[model samples]
Target: MLTTRIRNVDTDAQADAGMQSLNEPDFKALVDSHPKAIMLTAQDGSIAYVNDQFERVTGYRQEEIVGHNPSILSSGMHSREFYIDMWQSLERDKRWEGLIWNRRKNGETYPQWLNIYPVEHEGGAFYTGVFMDVGELTANDERLAALAYYDPLTELPNRTLFQEFLKARACQREPADRCFAVLFIDLDFFKSVNDLHGHDYGDRVLKQAAVCIQGVLRKGDLVARLSGDEFAAIVELQEPSEINAVCERMASAFRKPVSVDFREYFLSASVGAALYPRHAESASDLLLKADRAMYAAKTAGRACYRVYSAEESEQGQHQQMLSEALVASLKVAPEEFSVMYQPQYDLRSGAMVGMEALMRWRHPELGAVSPGEFVPLAEQRGLIHELTEQLVRCITRDLTRHDFGTHGNMRLAINISARQIADDRLEVLLEPFFTRLQLAGWCPELEITETHLMNLSPRCLDKLRDFGKRGVMVAIDDFGTGYSSLAYLHALPVHVLKIDRQFVQRLGPDSRDSRIVSAILGIADALELEVVAEGIETEAQKAKLQELNCHRGQGFLMARPTPLESLVRQATSG
Candidate 1:
């Protein structure tokens, strides 16, 4: 009888007598060339052999590491239990792959997505381990994580992270525990701080603010930066009666003066608190309740706190529902919703120079919803971008029907918000919206608020310049209200400035107002740009403004915001 024997390749290779003659040298070369760190270890976790990849990764030579334990490079990040579990899993014929923070030979700690696989002999014994570095890629992954959760400037958790924290807080409740409250904090006059001290200083102020707030907050509480000068905090209460104490603690945090760049300045922030279970059951409801309370606090006076009242909660919900409905209606019921053209009257001609396309919501149940209420709601909910696109389409259609501008062309002044300006895809999205219009020589003026220009992104500046070069008119609305007018005016591509209504309203007995008006008109004259004054409620205001050399005026004195149909008639006759 003839006996046939098949030897285990790894066992034979080690002896240089079994399959080592056929496969050992080839396997060794393959392991050395592999991108992953490859190593063979004994059952006691002692290093038997390591590939060149391991040497390159660990900065340790084979001879130095061969007799050493695998823990020679231990960073001590994982607990003893972690190693025990890992060893047991491998012993049980399992593999492990996950993200780990490890220190390098240079003492630089970095994130790594490591994949460790168990290589076994024919008898089911753990033999070798292979792991990919993935450190550089994991570093990028951490950057994305930071971008997702935290504000880069202030280094505070952003809105998304705040919401998650709030949700987690709400979930951690006993049956009879005191309800949690989410405080929405907003800095008073922060925009002016940015304008005066400049953005870099303003950013420092925000960072200091985060530090100050965190210093006052109780342990385990979350204070997150929601948006510009806005913060949200989830506070746990021992009892419902202690809610005011929590609010007082927050108010006291800002009561003291804060110093930035060695300049001591005192500031206060308005806070609005909405209690979970007591005020709201849902995250959206809680946020709305807090926001409405914040607005109420601002209305009463800044630098205070307001708890969400029953009435405020109801009103906020009603408004939220209305906004959602209006957004849906605008998309579906275009026939019902129509644009009323507010005439931008030219002082010289005393006729319409341009008409601003204002959106009006013809609510089926609530009669006509005014732009004053719904427009802002749209802005808060990010529905304004859609509304702006609608205006673009409608304005383009009207311009195609009529010649608007210097000759036969008339310009349509469309109001754009800060969100639209900051949106990087504004230009790309406009392409498809206007591709169908194809309105030649119909230049529409995009009027953005003075406040929108401050602390704007460089991408927005580039977008505005691109629009200017494309023959689109850019106008600065409510120009006198913002202090950055003179500075940002040069930075921005502006073709027009609409004088603030406050300036136009004070023309009767206010010489200071007259001086302001005069200075603005003189500047406009020097700049050779068109100027329009808003809120001409009286003949005196209109006449005074025109005498100041104001190029255009719009108010109840001329005509209110009229429907486009009536405006077309008004424009056609003039």
Candidate 2:
């Protein structure tokens, strides 16, 4: 008594016109011959039809299941929340597919791969479910467990499995015998690899890095990919000296370049370690301390390792207090923040051609907070956008009040962070500031760090190109300090390169720094980019730069950073 509701079509007229269409009986025959079990139900969940395969698979005849709901086959193995989630997906996405356990007519439960989708007919809406028995597919539990607990890209243990291992190892053993260390590994400049090359290339790099790291560890050690470009390892050591030896091996692993499709990438890691029963007692605390130490390694130049220390914990707490204070100050007393200008000079002409805008904050209780300390905190707290907006407002107001006189058309440079560049609203935020600069006949320049410039997203690069089209100049600050590839420099819309103070201060004829500066100037000349020598404190350094044909310079020797009022008065008097 199996039946299907079919739409009324003109078979007689179609035959006269020599057209072919399947009648209801033919459609039913096709369904009966399908290899997989198929069931049709009404919108109200009452079973309407079952194919031959469905009868064979479930051991149920059509007559007995016609009026019953599919819930009759539910094996009670899944929770209510599981069914809720499945239905939510069906309602929102209009289809669902997963594995489920169902009871057969013989009262035996088995796993089945099920797919449910909605169908519309002339009669009404209907639900069709197609399923297959998957008990044999999951018979190999180790393979199934691998899918559940391992990262597919690197074929390493995932964070969930790593945590389970850590907890069992630390808690199951006696406190005295818990003598293992946790190392947090973060790949340095991995984002640049992903940004410069496509994600496929980056994936290969990650796979190779995983192999390199795992090859160095002992058989009992465990390595897991915590997240993107971040990994963790569990190493057992007999003495503290063993920790250094293991970390050095891990650092050496990345020294060799990773080659992917004929392109070579130099990769490195920042490692931080924390020992059990020493730095921390619990697994979670050990992991956290290790992560903090890893960040310290990054701060102290990457490709290195640091063990957890009490002083680092104190610094972390102090940073947290500063972060909270910054949030409060931004909301209540924003006036404590201001902008100062440090003039840049023409080395040959000895005239002020431009000035860099520096952000300053004076906390009433803390006296003066360094930009290095709070700027990063603001970025971490997601308050950098607000800080940048405030900076622009202050610059606009101050410029409006003080006239530059003879230095009217000078270039005004402002520092831009990577987060600000990635923000979609950066254009709108700077539109008014751009207009103000245009009205004053002053040129606006954006100064970005060399490291950030190499890691900019494609969309951010497009935004920078658009800014260039709008007449905003782009300069790479602290040149030669970061791992910038020549290809990126050539591809970027760069107008100037500012030599870092580290190299400029050591500018002697026979010194390596002098040779580096010379090489930088040569590259700039070949690229048609201007060069600015920073930290020109001594006359000898200035003369050396001038002899090398470097034109622009900025340092304490030329002029110190001054308030807007003082800067205007000094320029007018000079």
Candidate 3:
């Protein structure tokens, strides 16, 4: 509403009187005293009168604006069709309410919620427009849209946005012109980064990785973070070679170091690609093929890319089914899973000093499934945390039920997943296990791979150090197979090293494995760490390991991985 002098006319009261009841003088006063921004435009769209509020909102004097067309305040933000539609609504309904961006006399553009209503007078017909500022509302709408479609950490388009983009592009073209590529990328060893450095550093690495990915793509291509550590891209393909070049550039971009917290961390990513028309017809299928190809790249030893193939797609589908089944099974019937203990013998004493608990799965319909098959799948699906918890609970219950720990004082060796160690609540989870073991007079050792140790973040290192202080023996399993620096190995809070089977399998006089074994034993001796030789299948291997003073050994020759009942009988009988 406007507030300005209107000669002797009561324009404010006249407007409230619907203009018909008021004389010209009363109409003038009525329009002048109104509080809203009210502008009266003649039938031809020329400005008839503007109230004080109109001049205040537009920063124009009434005399300067009154003689001009309402177009003088146009922000140039709307198209001709917009005005055509607005007039259509005004004519049909007598009033139209909408938002418009208009420029002020100071050249600043702002949004306003405007209403246009027809006004009839004895002389002629006119329209009165009432408007108020709504710039903040416009900004809030944009902010809500961004929060819905973007990843907060990376600020890249998220899965919901990516799907919308794919849908829009698919509908924008004919089938023949629908040629594009979808590349699914998974960061390698990213979990280790989270485990070692902390999630904040991991998030920084992901943000940098997103930027690197965007830098490599063509101008029209779309890159998005599908989820944590997984990114997807939509690329326009010209020649088939373009996909290869783009993938190479993507991998190269990720190969660089990401500096976080004053430390530089190197990372690698595996890419899987699916080409439109060639790989599949739909965006969902294309994404699926690309995901399968990505898993194939992981299977081929990582740091590479693979194009979709029928074989890889089949295998990927099977793996996905298994992953889903694992998630469902964990929720519905985890007790359907079981643990078996493999005896670990002391070569010098010829006695069972410990047993390593191994997970075994037997589905009601799928029959027996190897831990090798399902464990990694669970890790991929983020079910490993639950699986590990179930495993500890089962093993602890078995130990308590059989009284095996008291029977032979046999130590229980449990393999720990990186996810378990990274969990903030790991101390609480392990409290029961430690309490039960202490009551049984048996100490439990946690086995971790040498590779898992190599990437220990400072946080992971500190957590393991704390666990070690609590008297849980930390042993490195599959030692020789992983590349770990002596500096890192010496600094680790480890009490034992289990020589990998590949190294122990070749144990003989003057062999390379023998020399490596001797060196490992010497390092262990200097560090006051115990050494265990794994996969010793013969008396000859055992004798050779004993000659090198290896403290312990385990393999099929001692006993196969048996059920808890069998392990209990053996321990109690001994």
**Leading candidate by TM-score:** 3
Say which candidate scores most in lDDT.
2
TM-scores of the candidates are 0.54, 0.57, 0.68
User: Judged by lDDT relative to the true structure, which candidate is superior, 1 or 3?
Assistant: 3
**Residue-level lDDT for 562 in candidate 3:** 91
lDDT of 2 by residue, 1-574 (tens): 1122232434545322321222257757987888789987765456767888899888999889876878778776555655776787887999887666678999987656678887654434567888876443332345545335567788777786677567545653443644789999998878767876889889999988888889889977888999999999999887666888888888888877877778789998889999887888777999999998887776666799888887876676677688788888888888989999999999999988999999999998887999998887787567888788778978987987987775567899998887688667788898778877977888999999998788887888988898889888899999999987777789998898999999999999899999999999999988999999888899999999998989799999888889889988887787
lDDT of 3 by residue, 60-122 (tens): 888898757888887765656567767778769988876567889999876566778877775
Using TM-score as the yardstick, the better of models 1 and 3 is: 3
Judged by lDDT against the true structure, how good is candidate 2? 0.80
Candidate 1 lDDT over 344-449, as tens digits, reads: 7778778666667787667788888888877777775567777776666665566567553343455667787876776655776675544443355345677888
Please list the residue runs of candidate 1 whose C-alpha ends up more than 4 Å from where it truly belongs after superposition.
1-216, 219-305, 397-407, 431-440, 570-574
The segments of candidate 2 whose C-alpha lies over 4 angstroms from its true place after superposition are 1-178, 182-271, 280-288, 301-305, 327-333, 376-386, 455-459, 482-491, 508-526, 547-549
Off by over 4 Å in 3: 1-179, 186-209, 224-231, 257-268, 295-304, 405-408, 571-574
Go through the candidates in order and give each one's C-alpha lDDT.
Answer: 0.69, 0.80, 0.78
